[model samples]
Target: MWRDPGAPADSFYEVRPECTDVPKSRFRIKAGKTLSARKWHAAFSPEGYLDIGKTLSRIHRGGIHPSIRGEVWEFLLGCYDPKSTFEEREEIRQQRRLKYAALKEECRHLFPLVGSGKFITAPVITEDGIPILDPLVLLETNTDNGVVVPPQDNNAGSTMAPSSTGANLEKVTDKRTIQWMLTLHQIGLDVNRTDRTLVFYEKKENLSKLWDILAVYARIDTDVGYGQGGSLTE
Candidate 1:
């Protein structure tokens, strides 16, 4: 014959953190006092059925005895391998690869991020330390020292002769090319140890020395000429 311990009183069960998802039964002894027989009857009917929420309330209120720590950890970790499907893992891997591909595509534009330009300096440093002339024109005559000419100032005289204007324009163009070459060289040097190509070197020293030898070849081979600010893309 079943007997009631008395009126229903609030109770709790002991739940380990490892098995937070599955709580222990409320009928277990708790706090030196077992759950009242009537309370257990309402919590669990005959035929061994259990009410999870009612058990959860008992567990929350510390009404049940605690389980072994190791067993709780094993259950929480899913050591039982309930999801025995490899499909989920494969899907996760595919998603990760897709994410990586997207990132690579986004950053693909930055090619020569740290390498210098490929052209060597075309210079004949005068004993006084000034470049004599444009390096490309003098390549055939002498590779050791390029012609030295003072860079002309267009601002010195606004209404200069045609010859002067032509010279000025040539000088401006040379200066621009040289400046670009130097910038590439510096960036290439910075990324040297990283195994990136600074600039392609000629197999045999060409008589025609200029900054854009490899650059020209790259343009021809790849069919992509230099674009403004594209150097930074490197």
Candidate 2:
């Protein structure tokens, strides 16, 4: 006769690692006195190399101080190299900001719906090849009750015309550009659904920021494409 641990003797059983070595401290900073900037600098090496594991252990034990958590997160997230000095990190930050700005400018140039100051709007091509105004835009601009009034010049207008510089924006429907736009659109949809209960997510500007970051990532990592589920959840 076979021995049974608890359930019926014939029942099947499987075992898996419990991950006992992993830290179990709540992943949250403490309430009152948060980690200080000075303490943060001391946690890393003079060479700018951060002992992330050790630092995380400390955070797990004591929790981060609320005040310095934001700045500390930048270091934790690898936004700045742990081995870099304050001055070096600042320089890196400025360079990254400029790079991200340039990417946003490029995105705006390619997609008119982007950077249009209307966060909820998207480009919709009608049967006549003319773009229709987004319903959200209509909601804001139209005083009428849920009635959408089409623009006067439904036919191809100056907005749809080729640029004065002779750049045939409409004709340039390259494969890569189309893919990027599709990825961006999917990212926008994901952002809207992400953390919907959070007050910050309620603002369109915050959602726009999420979309921009995801779009830039998609542009850089063409192989990965746009991911759903857990990719946007965090």
Candidate 3:
């Protein structure tokens, strides 16, 4: 069911110090019970069938525990079917992760800001898809004293030859890659404001993850590409 745009959210997930002054009642789940991680895992049998009917009923009534929100969302978002076996689900997740890694590599090649543990807020690519090489342009990095450790590009290496990582990017003339570059700035812009005050996004890596995820999405979903509200939805 769609929530009315004018109606209040069922619950507030983020709680900054500024938000602590609000009454707790305002944040309570509708049914007084959120689905716990233990119960969620328990719903899957040893053979790996998820009791989706019960799960949906619980979520409809109370939402999910914050601790398992992302995990539960994988199901709600159709990452896997309720009847999928554990082995099948694991296979799907592994394949999806490999695909994500490969896509990130492609984005990294187009704009090194990706996988550099830093995020961009200013426009980096022009309308013509030419990238600005300002080394100091990155806003912030998720690092230990700013030591960035890029995500491994070898996750998909076993399935395919390693991607050409340090090729002369100046010769990049692929239409799809160029189109993807054109949207990087907007993705970065939206990422900068998305969850900026939330504790989860306090770490810059999460911000980078958000940018790369959307960048890759924009690259693949050419019809819809990137939009202003994509980050908010993410």
| Candidate number of the best lDDT | 3
Alpha carbon lDDT of each predicted model = 0.33, 0.53, 0.64
> What would the per-residue lDDT of candidate 1 be over residues 48-113, giving only the tens digit for each residue?
344546644654664433333332233235542323233554565589667654533332211111
Listed in order, each prediction's TM-score against the native is 0.17, 0.58, 0.70
Candidate 3: 10-residue stretch with minimal lDDT: 156-165
Q: Which stretches of candidate 3 lie over 4 Å from their true place?
A: 1-27, 30-33, 130-175
- Output the number of the TM-score-best candidate: 3
Tens digits of per-residue lDDT for model 2 on 11-34?
111212442343333433433223
Root-mean-square deviation of Cα positions for candidate 2 versus the true structure, in angstroms: 12.5
Clashes of each: 24, 6, 0
RMSD of each: 26.0, 12.5, 8.1
Off by over 4 Å in 2: 1-53, 60-70, 120-172, 230-234
Against the correct fold, how does model 2 do in TM-score?
Answer: 0.58
C-alpha displacement of 84 in model 2, angstroms? 1.1
lDDT of model 2 at position 27: 38
